[model samples]
Target: MIFQHSLYHIRWAEDKQILELVWKPTTQDLVAEEFQAALHNFAGFGATYGVSSMLQDMRDFMDYLPPELLRWRDIVVSPRYRQFGLQKMAFLYPPEMAPKNMGNAPIQIRGYAEEFFDVYESATDWLLTDIRPRKAG
Candidate 1:
């Protein structure tokens, strides 16, 4: 494990070159500041370890953030991931949270690939594979 907080814990999967973040269930609501802090910490790990693949196990995550916070993640936090060479990010959610597309549609990140999954094994498997298209120079 690299970093651990009350809300989440970050783990380094050396063999797969992936960084995993497991979110813990919270009794109270999650604020944007707290969420950003956690993500900053995750980015710190990525910068330190040169992580390319990321897996977020959000099965225990139950809090909801506002649209602004979500937009903040896309505009601010995501570039940090790309800056540090992050290639693929897989979000592992519970079956109940599965999108209507059934994880078929990918989130649009200019330099990176993001996918949603309901299974841990599938998330990790996709992370380890290089099936996504490469960015042009």
Candidate 2:
């Protein structure tokens, strides 16, 4: 099960629990509207399979979340995603970005366990591991 969009490719792995999203690089930065649309597509894809794990390949993506979008994401978008049953997300980032981008995980992903990795294989491997229940803070 695969879906392709202008901004990303979404695949529902045969492994059942995981849904993978590989973002495409853009020549220019994405505007807030475009980013919201892409995020909507992502949520819709995950809802289709009731997936528990997500592997996000962001190596080709270079845009950062602008302040407004970041606020909207944390305040609005992320809470809705939490209702969709997604428990974990593994982000595959470029090696050069591993250091700087890792700290942003908690801010970008809410109500889930997320980690950044420099390689796709390792990210996927981590997504497949036993997920312990996270206690509410």
Candidate 3:
């Protein structure tokens, strides 16, 4: 593990060029600033390491970020991934918590390709593969 915090744990798979993030369930009051700062720190680490792909394990995360934070992530944090040369990102969610439209649908965030999976194996498989959805004209 390269980085560890109360909110999340980050591990790098050097051979696979994949950065894995496992979010921990929050036990105290959640703070947005802290979360943002943690994300920035991780982004810096990823940039330094030239991370190309990411696997986010969100099954243990229980807190709901506010809409503003979500917007901030979309507007601010995501571009940093692109700047760092990130190509693919996979999110693993619990089967019941998986988004309704997540089935076999390709999601593009900022300029990188993203996909959602309910199983860790599936998520890792997708991340290790080179298949990316072509943008629609």
Which residue segments of model 1 deviate by more than 4 Å? 105-107, 133-137
**CA lDDT of every candidate:** 0.83, 0.74, 0.81
Q: lDDT tens digits, residues 1-137, model 1?
A: 87888889999989888899888998157777889998888888988999889988889988876798888888888889999999888898899996565456455455788888999889888888877554423
Q: Give the worst 10-residue stretch by lDDT in candidate 3.
A: 101-110
TM-score for candidate 2, please give it. 0.81
Residue 26's lDDT in candidate 1 = 81
lDDT of model number 1: 0.83
Task: Judge candidate 2 at residue 2 and give its lDDT.
Answer: 78
TM-score against truth, every candidate = 0.89, 0.81, 0.89
For 14-75, candidate 2 gives per-residue lDDT tens digits of 75568887888871576778778777777787877787788878889868877888788768
Model 1 earns a TM-score of: 0.89
Off by over 4 Å in 3: 134-137
Q: In candidate 3, which residue pairs get closer than 3 Å at backbone N, Cα or C atoms, i.e. clash?
A: none
Best by lDDT: 1
> Candidate 2's error at 35, in angstroms?
1.0
